[model samples]
Target chain A: MSISEAVVMNGGNGPYSYEQNSSYQKGVAAAAMDMIKEALPTTLDLYHLPLSSPNPIIRIADFGCSTGLTPIQAIETIVQCLLDLIKPIKEPRFRTLEFQAIFSDLPTNDFNTLFTNHLPVRRCYYAMAAPGSFHGRLLPTASLHFAYSSCALHWLSRVPQEILDKSSRAWNGERIYYVNSPAGVVGAYSAQFGRDMEMFLSARAEEMVSEGLIFMVVPGEPDLVHDSQTTLGSELELLGSCLVDMANEGIISKAKVESFNLPIYFPSEKELKQVISRNEFFHIERIQTLSHLKMHVAFPTPESRSLCLRVALEGLLCHHFGNELIIDDLFHRYSLKVAKSLFFLKPESHESISFSV
Target chain B: MSISEAVVMNGGNGPYSYEQNSSYQKGVAAAAMDMIKEALPTTLDLYHLPLSSPNPIIRIADFGCSTGLTPIQAIETIVQCLLDLIKPIKEPRFRTLEFQAIFSDLPTNDFNTLFTNHLPVRRCYYAMAAPGSFHGRLLPTASLHFAYSSCALHWLSRVPQEILDKSSRAWNGERIYYVNSPAGVVGAYSAQFGRDMEMFLSARAEEMVSEGLIFMVVPGEPDLVHDSQTTLGSELELLGSCLVDMANEGIISKAKVESFNLPIYFPSEKELKQVISRNEFFHIERIQTLSHLKMHVAFPTPESRSLCLRVALEGLLCHHFGNELIIDDLFHRYSLKVAKSLFFLKPESHESISFSV
Candidate 1:
């Protein structure tokens, strides 16, 4: 299945929902506000668009805004920046500029909860949601003004095809992610990440105005760090071990474990730069390491850490396994394993990168 | 609470979902196709709008699409008509006309299901959805090209305030609709319908361009038929009697029944005409009754008829009573009563009217 068909954050206003368990994401958005403001242009080029309505509108879309509490903060910041930019404009139409906030995610995403959580803001902006994968064209050509996404680019459009092929050398046999997989598996994951990002950027380039600014927050390691040394790597390793342990004990079929893998790939700063260089339409304005993110403070203990990951991964896991109880048990085991592992040491944690294009 | 908060069709693709139980609405759309084509302008006035884009987009919005299997058919028909209208134009910009189909409903509606069911069509048009009550402005002014709504106008913006007020003479005590209520109660519902329609039209006027057309399908009776004599009136009466029986058996509170009304009003043709005449921006191009609808063929038995009503009203009942079992029991009792009553005669059922404005 395509990642858009199967992956989403846990929905509803419950204990395990992304709405409740996104403190780390919320922290990232809050910390990234100053950078977002600094990167935005002083004057918005709204008049150049082909739109001829007397009342001009600036449409901003937030990609991967699951249940939308954290992403709303980022969206609000961007909207505020644009408002400040146009405050003293001499043109009457520019002074009366309207905005439309479009929250986009997979079609299966929990948009009802997103809209309900952000009801009052509907009066301020023409708030609506577009349902589709970000890796494809979702809006009209040159229809968008600003684009923002937070901590969502780590997801590949789909798992690499070779990793699932039984005959391929790149087939990931035991590992669920590319953390400690074979070198071929790592290559396949890296190649897929490049292709997915290219598709994503190409779609955004078509949908956005020429003068549009896109700020993306993603999880990546520094150039000096190895994939296995990052905190994200350790977490995936612990999760994979838990599944393998369950399979060895004959709880779930080992064949099932071998066939399944998460469709997430956290790139390093070097890898991100390489991918951006290949795309011709956009230039990197700035790529700053977010020093303000306190991952340890956001997720202090193993229990809280497990919850954050659980909310993010539950939909993907449940869709692959077709069992919610198995996911719950796996997360419980992974949390216990985290307590014993060196995960809390947070060795060179790598989930802080904000780049403007 | 507003109608948008409490009202939704049964969600999920289950036996009780609106997706499964909307055969009558589907047939009405299919039957109304001929009239829809005839009334549509032979040439679409797309160039008049102030869009200056190298590529132009024609946006169509379908309001009150519950779970969306039926409204999609109407949307596809309308898009096809516009495509035919623009096929002969020699202008290069007119040759590649793009469309954006926006599906609108209440915030609580199951938009995930709506998007998923129509996934393939997303490639044909940049299809998306907006969440809000259609009685208010949901799109930008002069942004929409074609507006279509089917079988959703009868739902008032909310239950009439006077009908719920204890101090008022119009307080509909123990009656769930205005079928045979007191004169004051009927007047309250009629007034609410008028105000809701006016607001709905005003919003559409602001959202549409000067040459834009809106086609709406609503349920109403002819001028000669009394409100109590119609099949819709008999159906509401049966549902109310079922609730009263449960109340007498100490199953639920009478006050609960008294405080509840359907927020649904089936206007007469004369009433619809009066409301349309009050709105200044729109002129009646054509108002045709859908004679091709085969209500008897669509739902031949009482069990099927009960199911159709259950799928439409279950969410509203569950929201008000705070229990799913009560709604099931109420509908079951109502079904048995329908089998024993004069419902099979079909007694001039009034639920088909299509008008272009």
Candidate 2:
């Protein structure tokens, strides 16, 4: 599908949107703040050039900044870390330092809300928004010092070509995702993720100053499982079941169900590390998956989980089906499914990766 | 009056606003564009350090950028000029140059329109908004390349203190402006302008790279004029007369009329240059007043003039008077006054000045 026709979050303050149900995102962002603080000094130390001889402005870009307050929290974290690092630099020339933070997302993202509602409250750095996809170059050559993305890289630039071709060995027949697909289908999905990640890293490498760093937080699958037991994985399974049941009842066409494939992927830790190794634009400083349960005892309830999930996926689903699609009914059934399967659901692990460019 | 209490332009796309009556401003901006294009190459050459040895990003700032399309045109002019200059520089390292344009205005300036409506269509440079008064530091130390302000500097940071002091010799009795006022009132206005301009230059000096340039387009009176002969000056006189007539008919309180004073001033060319020399932050390169008559043969009509004046001053007026004030009636009267006085109206020359830090 063309990018313009693809799903985006419900814009502004719409109900059941990423903008409205953003508590989960805020929690994830808060957890990532410590990791960002830990990584900043080491990242700045690796730069060969001094800070303020020619340019006192340090540049950073946040990829996949959908309409929410999370980008504001993320920016404050990065800006504060930079301030702490710059405070001790005894060089007189480095005394006057400033920061430039650039926020990037798809063209359809509600950047107006980000600028009007979120940016006015921010004070640490000069704020900018660059509207584009992160899988390609969004800034000038070697202009970035640090690049960040939180819970956004799971999206593929486009649906894998192999899945769309019914003749291919990797054809995902009558399924919307790779959860229970054939070996060939799984391989195609993995290959696509690798390609997209490679492009993402390569573009950043070209845009970053030498020794710059990138920090990303992505939804990760639990190890030793082909089918996901994590809440996110299970939720998708539930959503898929709803569609299947609709198809079974003739409420939706079976052919339509078969043709639909979500442009989302959740890689295991091993798959993520392998992609990094394949694309040598960055040296992996650290990579770890933190359990949400271990960090916060009160895991997101089914209702909250469904709201968050709907906010993230509703735009895409609406685009694929129709704007008039019965999203509320779909989510209502998915919420019930989630509640019924609550005890069996495993809390998802968030993958945090830090690397030097 | 406190800045927080003073009226700003009617924000967004209101009936009569900066966004609505911006053609004259645009025409003035186009004239200033030539002055900017002429100054940039010479200013860049004067910098001891090259454009992108340590910092590859060139920065320009536009002060008083409320919600309007004029800023976009202004930025495009500056960016296009820089690109032209950078094209001939064969140095391999300088080939990858980028531009960061910062737009600044008051906290209440309609930046939402700037970001949402105007910025998205712009692709040449990275866009940023710095929210603050220009009379104070709005950027990091030595961080700007070029600073431009057109039709904005006349606004004082706050109403002159003497105007508010009823017992002072400069107390402006039953007048909203200094024109045709007592000698003390003119001195008070001139003193306030001098102070504000000094602060503006001093802050720019600290924020600009050595030999960085500043191009300002401000309203100016012809030589040997204490009271302004400009259209802006005459309109204010007309508006003041309307208020006076209302006061005479007991339609409004006489004390309310006496308490009002506009926080705006249009300086003469000699006065402008004198203040720049006094501050000693910038060396004057070229300062000239261009006749509006020579530039545009058909001066703005009374109807057009009233609309333009209302857009610029209505917010401030509404704040001082009650929001219920019949602004239409006031402008209608003012428009008639303008039409009757048209034959004696002297077209004001806009002052254009370029200086190097």
Q: Estimate each model's TM-score.
A: 0.93, 0.78
For model 1, residues B161-214, the per-residue Cα lDDT tens digits are: 898888899877888888777778888888999999999999999988778888
Clashing pairs in 1: A50-B52
Q: Which candidate leads the pack in lDDT?
A: 1
lDDT of 2 by residue, B151-187 (tens): 7888887778887788899888887888777888878
Cα lDDT tens digits for candidate 1, A1-357? 455577888888899988888887887777678777776764346556444457578898998877766766767788888777777767777766788888899888888787766656345678778888999999988888788888888888888889888899988887888887777888898899899999989999999888776778877766676654554666887888888998898778888788888888878777888898899887777777764655567877888889988998887777776752387788889888877766476534435444433
Summed over model 2, clashes come to 2
Model 2, residue B21: distance off in Å is 3.6
lDDT values, one for every candidate: 0.78, 0.72
Residue B52, candidate 1: how far off, in angstroms? 4.7
iRMSD per model? 1.4, 3.9
